[model samples]
Target chain A: MYLLRRGDPTMFETFWRGPIGESATLVIPGYQTMSYFSDVGNLCWFLEPGFEREVRRLHSLVGNAAVEGYHVLVGTGSSQLFQAALYALALPTANAPVSVVSTTPFYSMYPPLTDFLNSGLYRWAGDANAFDGDDYIEVICSPNNPDGSIREAVLKSKSGKDIHDLAYYWPQYTPITHMLAHDIMLFTVSKCTGHAGTRIGWALVKDKEVAQKMSKFMEQSTIGVSKDAQLRAAKVLGAVTDGYEHQLAAAAGGDANLLFHYARRKMAHRWCALRAAVAASGIFSLPNEVAGFCTFTKDTVTSNPAFAWLRCEKQEVEDLESFLRENKIITRSGTKFGADQKVVRISMVDTDEAFGIFVNRLATIK
Target chain B: MYLLRRGDPTMFETFWRGPIGESATLVIPGYQTMSYFSDVGNLCWFLEPGFEREVRRLHSLVGNAAVEGYHVLVGTGSSQLFQAALYALALPTANAPVSVVSTTPFYSMYPPLTDFLNSGLYRWAGDANAFDGDDYIEVICSPNNPDGSIREAVLKSKSGKDIHDLAYYWPQYTPITHMLAHDIMLFTVSKCTGHAGTRIGWALVKDKEVAQKMSKFMEQSTIGVSKDAQLRAAKVLGAVTDGYEHQLAAAAGGDANLLFHYARRKMAHRWCALRAAVAASGIFSLPNEVAGFCTFTKDTVTSNPAFAWLRCEKQEVEDLESFLRENKIITRSGTKFGADQKVVRISMVDTDEAFGIFVNRLATIK
Candidate 1:
């Protein structure tokens, strides 16, 4: 069993622990909240007007990305959109399964989700840089998950299409260096607003036809995301964006900044604390921190990533996961992210108490 | 364009309409609802204790199905479960695309959803009975959508698996015929509680492995259904089951009867009114209504189908949908439901005002 299950609140709590109140929580009436679908667009079933408005509003408020000339498609979460991206990129008419690759030490779910059902449309061909392919789809997870490293499309080729998973690109997760303009970029409410329970995410697609196809895949797959969840997500986004638009924080009346500023502060604190704990542990190592000028935050800032990628230098800890498990520090094996056994990923987003316990345990590692 | 959108409330509005209140509405506490996943069982992310309890309670109270030995898997909606079923049923090792066949005049979305991605894992092979194949999957939509016909597995093959889409099998839509003990049976809150906006559905599977695979399909598909919607669904279901268990109607103490009884009365009235209008027209024909002794209601009950399947006898109507469109009586084209153009399906459960308009227009069909 994964070591995370031993805690009272557990390691999963580390992720998405920000405060959300009445402004974020939505109560849908028992009666019809809205029509099952959008009437004006080709999008089928329940693109709640409030949801669309708030999503567009949030993007504009952050100024981290551009929405114009793009088709915004909502999904169950970024995970489904990732699948939809694969479906949209894969040529249905092709005779052979399209090759799919990501960088080494990449996110693990990509390989399995890409190949599940052994669907003949796409196959997971590992290591984007190592592959000698003219025809393929490359996935680039920016401000990477296990490690807080910014990335760009690694396999630059004419025959390849890129799916940029900007899940970690929000100001809190990483420095929003510039407006992310890509063919397909994915964002999720779970990470940005800390409402993972809502299970809402969206893709900003440059090509309208590709966006339509991706939405069609959602229609065929789940008949679109839940209306209740969408409305709730809309409220959450609105709450965050309201801070910027209405300048709720500038009035200096509240204990917390707007959701964005609040997240930025909390993440910075945790990242700093985590770095100290690792520094205190001479046996462990983390990547050197880097910062970029974030247009949204208007400062040069480093990422406060969701997971801490740690590499063990000692031979006594051959498998970092086993070593962490023995120490009661829950973690995911680094190889799960396509790296070696010397490395493991630990959740830093856990409850502050849990993270303290995690850091204390790390500090004691002699 | 489809004819259904012409009505005041529209055709899509017919599916879910009920008087639900704050008791049924869910306010998801922003605190950790559960870990992003469950630590135990094959089910990964969510198994809301309330969701599973309420699902089984509702099913048992209605006496339409058995969940005693089944694994109840929740989904975003039955439409999503439909795709998951396709994924779980298709042989990953098979050399050829697994043929997925359903009866003619079937639910329209079946064929389109099956072929939407044009995935090589499964291909839509029309008409179950006509296709003589040992290697295929047959979908039996008991009290089928669009046409509202009660059906069974048309093709009995040792090599073929059956997916019983019982979306329309609720006491409101049809009689509680028997303990529907199918291997894989699907039910939805959209039909049962008239909350299509919630987008919650569950599958009761006899085989644990198949259930696990279906759940995995959900995990990889949408990363599980929305937790907020699931909690709300549990509340809706709990309310209905409470009415049934307490025998709300016997005491005459509640505002509404058990959801089943309330739906039964409303649907029967609409179906009777619809038949009278069709009879008055003299240019349209409808399938005869069949009744059976319902164990749950303990009476000989007739079907009050969610839709009215109409066949145009007059030669003037080359395409029945166009004729209806001209009359402002909205309907789905028969060809769209995998049938001939002469037939059309009308939503019987449209709003009182809209259904009245539909019946009035039908009376003038000559």
Candidate 2:
């Protein structure tokens, strides 16, 4: 019998196949324990009653009343939610041409995701100011990726609809009050909790109709989110809230200034280290280092150019990528981020040891 | 500030809002130790070198070939793979009228999923026998759900493009050797490994062009499957393969005869009990007692209604569902499975004690 190519079997028929008495089991024991339920992990839609109650209780700890009525839709991560939201809004309508707009040099995934969804149908329209409110949807990622720049826009949809994407409104980088109180907000646990593997995020939407439609689309697309991931996220969130409460109470009662003082001093030290490192690495340049990431350009002094703008030559970016792989360190070239070459992004979120190694590598590159 | 309607948030803009930090933190601890890689759990397109090696090893045990050159794609589940397949194949073309054909009472998810994809241009053609090769894609699920039936025609795509969806070719089931030789197959760990919560599934396609296009679609659709979920699946599959080897070794060493005899006796005893219970309960009539499920109909004897044939003008099935629920017995209504209202599916895989309880409850139904 000839062996078939991989991924060719029918799914609907395969699911009911009797337990293959094969020696190999396909899932880990812990995962197996939680696989039966629908909402146990970070990729969940339903919140435990207790978890929901606690979240409401801590509402005052974050932003203001602009968030009212906007409930959270958790996903595998914000990435999943981001793509889902884009698909939901891009449903074809004859009255207007559907377009996606975002700030230039925005999150790298946006254009690819848009292209993937749009295929050849719709195109990305950069610049929030250019939207005519007749045929476009705008995406705004604040405390943005790469540069960590936030753009405040009074965005309106083609049909005079107002939409907002407040993905990075966290207390760590900026004051909580600075959050854009728009109709929708997206956030992820990976960034705040430093649990990138969890792959969990949420969309806070104020409109019931849009939420229902999105839910339907999700159900039709990926079914509901993973139950196990959601439960785990809920448990983690509960623990953090408890920690925050304990810290706040201690501060209020004057029992310990150590907790707050240590946090402040640690932030100061990290910032100072980053500043000094940038200065020492003559090949790097950055506008500021206030947020999670810093964007840098090649200093032009090095014999090896930082980036080769490839769009003009009409060659794929992979050839340049091969050149970078020869070097020990890895950097995301500008093409992936939908930018012209002559620019590259470097992330400073690594651990002190790892960050030190990266800085050292950069220093030697020149 | 005015509160926006519940659903009208900016589609792509919601990611900026910080997640409910405390809630997310509560759920992270449970899955930290778990591996998230497995072909059956999610798509395998993003497998790392180490995990890829392991997956290949497991596939070799099953007598399947390694996935290379072709783009391996992952989905939220095998269900998503099914949707994606339909999307790719049903996209409009000049000669093709964009039609989908499936056997009657097919995998219940097909109709809903197809509609949900809403390629307004494509429509479902229910009769496979009359399917014209020109503009239609036929979906065939083997070891089919509801009725564990396999089809021969599904081995070849109607248009000769290639048969897709190979979910149930494991060792325990009657393998369709011809189908595996060339058709596209989709498989998931949900059934095989009982890890449904991870929501991972893979599709195998013989054609490289189809594979590449699907990969691009996946990247656009959900970026990629959850990395954490994929890793866990990989670990679990390794253990399962080991278990299969041990079982085979025991069988060969003449140490498993006693265990096999015990299992045979146990199955015989359960069937006997089930037969006795059915004789005692006149309200239901079963199609056959041998299959994975005992299908019931409301019309069995004169003046005795087999639950499968019992009809209500509006919502009598729901009434029956409530009646069963009051007994603390849970069984899916046929309506949910794309069957007639008079039919209800009763899984025979429950423990003998649970079956006894179910029998006792049925005795009380009349």
**Highest-lDDT candidate:** 1
Residues A90-199, candidate 1, lDDT per residue (tens digit)? 99889898999888778878988887757667889998988997899999988887787888888877989999988877887777778878999999877776666668
In Å, what is the interface RMSD of model 2?
A: 14.9
Q: What is the alpha-carbon lDDT for the whole of candidate 2?
A: 0.47
Q: Which stretches of candidate 1 lie over 4 Å from their true place?
A: A1-20, A38-45, A244-250, A253-255, A316-318, B1-20, B32-35, B38-44, B245-250, B253-255, B315-318, B326-330
* Candidate with best DockQ: 1
* lDDT (tens digit, per residue) of candidate 2 on A1-366: 111111111111111121211111222233233333334342334333343444444344454224466765766667667655655565555443367777666666676655543332345666556566666667776656545565665465445333354444444333343434666667665544334444566677776666666665666677655544554445545544554566567655431222112222333454455456556654445544343221111111111111111211223433333333454555566656656564555544334454466555544533
Can you write out model 1's per-residue Cα lDDT over B83-127, one digit (the tens) per residue?
Answer: 888888898889888999989888888888888666667889998
Instruction: Give Cα-based local distance difference scores for all models.
Output: 0.76, 0.47
Q: Cα deviation in Å at residue B280, candidate 1?
A: 2.5
Candidate 1 docks with a DockQ of 0.45
| TM-score, one value per model | 0.91, 0.66
Candidate RMSDs in Å, in order, are: 3.4, 12.7
DockQ of 2: 0.15
**Model 2 chain A poorest 10 in a row by lDDT:** A297-306
What is residue A309's positional error in candidate 1, in angstroms?
1.8
Question: For candidate 2, what is the DockQ-based docking class?
Answer: incorrect
